[model samples]
Target chain A: MQIKHAASAGTLESSDITITLKPADNGVTIALDSSVEKQFGRQIKAQIEAALKALDITAVAVEATDKGALDCTIKARTIAAAYRAADVQDYDWEEINSWIN
Target chain B: MAELRRIWLTIDHDEAAAWAALLTKSGLAVDHQVEVTFGMFEGETLLATASLYGQIIKCVAVDPAAQSENLLAPLLQAAFDQLDDNGSQHAFIYTKPSTQAFFQSLGFKPLAHSDEVVLLERGYPDLDDYLHTLQQAKRPGSAAAIVMNANPFTRGHHYLVSQAAQQYDTVYVFVLSAERALFSAADRLAMVKLGTQEFSNVVVLPTRDYMVSSATFPSYFLKDRADLAVAKQQARIDAELFVQKIAPTLGITARFVSEEPLSPVTAVYNTELAAAFVGHIQLHVLPRKAVAGAPISATTVRQALQNADQSTLEKLLLPSIYRYIKEHSSHAN
Candidate 1:
C-alpha cells in the first residue's frame, strides 16, 4: 500500500526497535542503526524489507533504530509503522499474521 | 532491579530539586524553563532525565551508575514521544561533541558543529533539503548576506540591505523565522520583501530553523532569557553554523550589520559574531541610520506602535512597510 503520511512505532529500549516512516517519491530506502549492525545489519534490513514487501508499501523512507531486537520484533515494528504511515487504523490481524509467519 | 517509575516535572514539581542535582552531577546546567522535563527513577534515585524546549531537546543527563541500565535510549524515546504529542515533526539537540555518537544511534544526524557544541537534528526536510533549496538560489558573484529579525521592517533595515546591494554583485537577506517577536515571522518576512523591492540585487529568504532559530539562538526569544555567557555561546554556535556550512554553500563572502547602540543582547551577539567570523568570513559593521540625531530602530518602531503614533511610524518605516503594518494592525484590532 502507498504510505499516506509519516508515522512511527516502537521504542529505543532494549531488545526492541523504533521504526520511523516518511512518504517518499520512489523506491524504498531503509536507514538502519543498530549496535549489531556489523554482525546482523544485513539480516535486520532484510527482515524490514520483507515486511514492507508483505504490506506492498512502496515509495517510503524508513529509519529503524535497533536495540538488538529479534526478527519477530523487527517485523512487528515495521508492519506497525507502515500501517500507521498508510493511515490504516483497522488491522487485518489474520492477513498480517500470515505475512509474519 | 525494580522497574523505573517516570517523573513528569510539568505534572509534579516536587522532584525539581532532585532533577537539578542530577543534572549538575552529570555536568549539565539546569535550565528550569524547558517546556517539558522527564525523569526516570529507580526507587528514590533519579537515574536519567531529558527536557524539551520547543523543538529542541536539551539538558539530558544519565547517571554513570545507570549507564549499565541503558537509560538514554528510553529517555530519548520519551522525549521524541513528547515531541510527537506536541505535533512537532522535527527536533534538534545542541549537545557536546563527545556524546554525538550515542544520539546518532537514536537517528539524529549532525548538521553543524563548533569546538564547544554540535547541532544534530532528526526529521524530514532536514538541513540537506534546506541547503538544496538555497543552492537553487545561489548566484555566482561577490555575494554578501544580512540576517535580521526586522520585527517591523524599518528604514534602518532598508539602509543595511541597500548598502549591501550596492557593494555586492548579489545580496541575500535572511529574515529570522522565529515567531517570538511582536510581529509574526510571515509578517516580518513580507515586510522585508516589500521593503527591499527596489534593490534589484537583493533576494529575500526565510532563515528557517537553521539561523537564529530557538534552536540556534534561543536568547532572541524573551522567555529563553539567557545570561551573557549563554548568549555568547549560542551566538558562536549560530555564527559557526553560518561560516562553516551556510556561507560556503551559498558563496556568501561577507555579512553586513549596523552598529548596535541599543539592545545589549544584540550587542553581545554582534561581538560574538565578529569573533567567530574572524579568518573565515568578512564582517562589516555600518553606522546606524539616524533621523535627526536619534537612530532609527525597530524597537523605536515598536514603541510607536504601542502608542499608536502614526507620525513617528511613518518617519521610521518605508511607505511599503508602513502600509503593510497599517493594514495588518487594523485587521488585528
Candidate 2:
C-alpha cells in the first residue's frame, strides 16, 4: 500500500512525502524527495524509525518532505500522521516525566 | 488635658453609628466610609467613635473639645489597640499631609499617593509581576524550574531565588496576581525587583488569576476538599496550559519549586504535569532552607507582624524590606 502525507507551515510551500508498506516485514523503508533528502536525509530516516516504533507498526515504507523540524517534533508529527492513516484513534504514547529519578 | 478612658467596643453597625454620632458632636465630620476609624480628645478626655462598614471598621474619631494630653496620639493608639486585641489584619487611617508626620512618628507610612487619597498599607507588597515574568522565561539546559509569590521582597525570598539560580540556568518564578491580595501589584513588582537585583538570570512574571486564586484552588491546598478529583483535574489542565503554551513561549521547559507542604495541590499538579510533559520539560522541587523551626512562609512573617515580634520578622525578611517596614511603621505608629 502507498500513503501520501503533506505537512505545511503556511505560505512556506508545503512539504510532501510518500511511504510504501510491504506485507510481513517488521522494519520501515523511507524514501525522500531530492530537496528534502539534501537537507534532512539522515535525520528523517531516524525519525521515521522512531515514529514507527512509537506506533508499534514495524512493517512500513515511509517518505517525508522536510521543513525545519527537530528530531522530537518530527517524531511527534510522524506518529500523528501514521495514526491518522491507520484510523487508530488511541495510542499509548509514553508521558514525559519532569522529575529526575 | 482630657482624661483617657479605655472603652472596649465591638466592630458592629450600632457601634459604628454611635461612634459616628460622637465624632459629629465633637466637630469632626465623618462621612463614615468602610474600613475607616475616627476619634477626638481634649486635655485628658478621650472620645472614641468608630463606623463599621461591612467587615471593615471605618471612621474612628476622638472629641476635639475634650481636654486631653496628646489626645490624637492616644486616641489613635487606643483604636489600634482595640483592633489588635480583636486580631484584625486590616487597618487604616486618613490624615492630612501636615499630620502625616505625626502619624509617621506613631508608625504609619503613606500607602501610596493617589489623586483622591494618600493610602497607607500596613503589610508587605505583593511581588507577583516579577514572579510571572520569571515563569515566562525559558529554562536553560532543560534542567530546573523556579516559583515565588513575592509578597514583599524579603531576604528569605532572595535566598530562595539565589539557591534556585545556583541549581538551574533558568529559574521561572510565578508571582501571584489575584486582585484581592493585600499589596498593590506595582508595589509588589517593585519590591521583588529590588529584592532579586543580584540574581541576573531569574525571570519573574505574574501568575494570572485562574492559576493562583482561591476561585480555582488555594495556593497550597492545606485543607482537604470534598471534590479533590475535580480540583486536581482543573489544576492539571491549568498547569498543562502553562507548561505547554506559556512556558514554551518564554523558552522555559522546566519548573523549579520550593518543597513546602503549604501548596500540596500545586505540588500534585506539577507532578502530573511533569509526567505529561516528560522528556520535554523538567520539574525540580528544592528542600526548604530553614533557621529555626520549619521552612519560612509569608504566613509566618505576617503572624510575627501581628504579634509585634519584629525579631522573627527581621530574621525572615531582607534588610531593605525590614528597613522600609520599620521606617514606615515607626512613622505611622
Candidate 3:
C-alpha cells in the first residue's frame, strides 16, 4: 500500500535512528543526517534504500536522522514509519519478528 | 614561542581534516557546535587541539609524543580566556580517566563517568550561587523539592506541586534547565511560574546542572537513548550530585515525583535513584492523578492539542497554562 500521509518513528538518540517520511511525487528522495556521516554515510544511505525497497515503498520522501544505529535498528524504524504513514493499525509481526528471529 | 603557537581551525581551514582525524582517532566525534577551535602547534605539526563549543570544551587531543607534565593547563587557560571574555563563568570538559585528577586540581569537579570518559566542570554549576540566591528567600522549615519539565504546565503538574505544597513547609520546584524540550524553556518556565503562583511557599528555580542536566549524563542517554548500563552510571552520578551537593545546599528533606505509568526510562531512573538514596533522603513516588479514569499527563495534553480536541485539553490543563499554551502546540522531546 502507498503511504498516504507523513509519519515518523524512533528517535535521534545514540544507537537509534529517527525516520520521517512523506509522500513524494516521483522516486524516493532520501536525505540522511548522521553523526558518523564521514565514515558510514554511504552505508547508511544504502541500508535505508534497501529497507524501503524491502517494504515495497517505491516512492516516498525520506528524512533520516541517524545516531550510530546498526542495520537492524535502521530497518525497524523505517518499517515503523512506513506502517504509520500507510495508516496501518496493526503491524506485520511476522516481518518484524524476522529481524530478531 | 614559535614552537608552541596556538592554531585555530575553521571548517575552511587547510588542516580541518587533520583536526577531525585526531579527534576520531581519540575515540571522539566532531561536536556539531564547532565554534572556535584551538590547537597547539610545534613548528609544522599539530601537537595538541581543543575545541570550545559555547561553554563546553570538547574534541581535545594531545599527540602522544607531545605528552608532558605541563601539556594541558596552558591549552585550558587559553580556552578559559575565550570563555571568560564571553562572560561564561561555568564550563564542562570531557577527558579520559587518566586525566581526571589533572583537571580536578584546576577546580573542575567530576560530574559523571563511564568506561571511556569522565565529564568535569568548572565555575558556573556552582551550587553556592543557587543557595546564595535562594538562602534568604527559604522559608523556615523542612523543604521538599521536585524537578519537572512542565512542558506546558498541565494540571497533572499542578496536582504534583499542590501535593508538595501541602505536605512541606516549602516546595522548591526546579524546572528543567535544558531548552532541548519542544516547548521552549522560556515558555515552560513562564507557564509553570504562572500556574503555580497560588502556592505561597513554592519557589521555582532552574535545575541548572544540579539535577539531571545534559552534563550530568552521557549526552546520548539524555537524548532518550535507553542504555540501562549508561543510565545506571548517569543516575548514580546525578543522585550523588543531588545527595552530596544540591540537597545539602538546599536543605531538602525529600524529593517528589509523579509516578510513571507512561515512560519506562523514568521508571528505571526513579527506581535507581531510590535504591541509591535509601538512607540519605526521602523519595516520594506519588500516584498519578486521574481524570475520568484516565491518567492526566503532559503527553495527553499535547495529544489533545495536536488533535484539536479543546475539551480534552481543557480538562487536562489549568486556566493559566491554557491561556499561554492553547494555541501553542508541542511534541515530546
Candidate 4:
C-alpha cells in the first residue's frame, strides 16, 4: 500500500515524500523517496511509525512530508495520522502503559 | 607606612536630613522619613564610608585617592576588631558587584543577592520565626532545621543539603536575597535551584533584612556600631522583635547554620537568640563538612576561581556550576 504526505510554508517549495509499505514475516518494509531520504535518513520516523502500526497486525502504508517540524513533534504527528488512517480505536493503551509501567 | 586605626559607629539623626542628603547625592528617590541609623566607619582619616538600614547596608565607599593604597582592608579589619572589643555579637556589610573584590580581599564573603545589595554577616542571627514557620507547615510531628547559604550552589552544597534532608522530613533553604552579591539574586537562585533539583522536599526562600542584618546584635556589618553600643543594642532589639513577631505571619521557623570555629561571635549570638526564644522556635548549627584539601566554603570556592584552579574548583562545585562560571567568564572576556 502507498500513502503520500505533503507539507509547505506560504511561499517556499512544498517538501513532499511518498512511502510504500508491505507486511512482512516479522516487521514491515518501508521505501522512501529521495526528498524524504535527504531530510530524514532512511528508516527514520516513517519506518518507526509503520513498525508501531504493524505491531497491532495492521498492514498499512504511510507517508509524510515535514516542513521543519522537530523530531518529537514529527513522530507524534505521524503516529497520530497513522492510527487514524488504520481506524485503530484503542492505541491509547500503549501510550498510557508507556507512562505507567 | 603608618598603621591606620579603624573607627566604626552607628549615627542617629533625623531621617529627613541625613538619608535625604544621601539620596539626593546618590540620585535616588526620597520617600519616607523612617527612624533609621547609619553605620559608618573611619580608618586613619575616614578612607571609606557605608550605611546600614535594618539588615541591609548600602553606599559602601572607599576614597578613590586611597584606592591604590587599598584602604578598605584596614578599615574592615578595624570594624571587626572594634566589634570584637565592644562585645558586639555580629557585623554585616553590603557592597556593589563592581566593588566585591575589594571587600572580599578583606575576608568579606559573598552572600546571596537581594534586590540591590549583597550582604555579608559577621555573625549568624537566630532563626526563631523560621523554625516556628517550619513547624507550622511540616506534617504533624515532623520537624525541620535548615542552614541556608549561597555556596555558589556546587556539589558540596548538594552534599550538605542531602545530609540535612536525611534528618528532617522537610528542609527550608533560605537564600540570602540581599542585593550586594556579585551574582544577581536571580542567578544565585537559579544555581541553587538547579543544584538541588534532585532533592524533592527542600523548599527555598529568601532571607530578608529582618533576619540577617547588622542592625541586630551582634552587629554584623560595621564595628563602630559598637561605640554607640546602647543605640545599636536597641536597634537589634527592635529588629529581633520584628522578626520574631512579624515573621511568623509569613510561615518560617527554625534556622540552620553551618558551624564555623573561625567566627565564634556568630556562634555565641545564635546561642543567645535560641535561649531567648519563648518555646516557639529553635536554632540548629550543623557541623562543618570538609572534603580533604578544601573546606566547603563560598570563600574557598571564590579563592579557587580567583586563582584559576579549575581542578580545585571542580572538586568543590557541581559540573553544571563549573560550566556556568566558564561560560560566563568567556562571555565577559
- Candidate 2 Cα misplacement greater than 4 A, ranges: A1-101, B1-145, B154-156, B213-227, B262-267, B326-332
DockQ scores for all predicted structures: 0.65, 0.00, 0.01, 0.01
Docking class of 3: incorrect
lDDT of 2 by residue, B120-228 (tens): 3221111123234444454546334455556655656777778777877766566666545445565566667767767877666666433444323343333344245
- Residue B101 deviation, candidate 3, in Å? 3.2
For model 1, which pairs clash?
Answer: A1-A56
Q: Tens digit of lDDT per residue, candidate 3, span B1-333?
A: 313344556534666777777777776666544577777766666767787766777777877767763555557767777776896657787678898876765546676554556767865425545556667566678999998888778888899999989999989998887767768877888888999998899998877765766656444224455566656666666776677667766689899988886676677678767876789889999998899999898878877777878899889888768877754544421
CA displacement after TM-score superposition, residue B59 of candidate 3 (Å)? 4.4
- The candidate that wins on lDDT is 1
Q: What is the DockQ of the complex in model 1?
A: 0.65
Question: Model 3 lDDT vs. the true structure?
Answer: 0.74
How do the residues B194-291 of candidate 4 rate in per-residue lDDT, one tens digit apiece? 77778887777665544443333324433333334323333334335434553354344555556665544444445545554447665566676777
In candidate 4, stretches whose alpha carbon ends up further than 4 angstroms from where it belongs are A1-101, B1-147, B214-218, B221-253, B329-333
lDDT of each: 0.86, 0.52, 0.74, 0.48
Per-residue lDDT for A1-101 in model 3, tens only?
A: 58887777774345887677777667988877676889998998888788788778888888776768898888788888899889997877887566432
lDDT of 2 at B83: 54
State every prediction's TM-score relative to the real structure: 0.91, 0.41, 0.61, 0.41
lDDT of 4 at B188: 75
Q: For residues A7-75, could you state the per-residue lDDT of candidate 4 as single tens digits?
A: 111101123222222223354444322334565655466545544554453444333333334444444
Shift of residue B243 alpha carbon in model 2, Å = 1.9
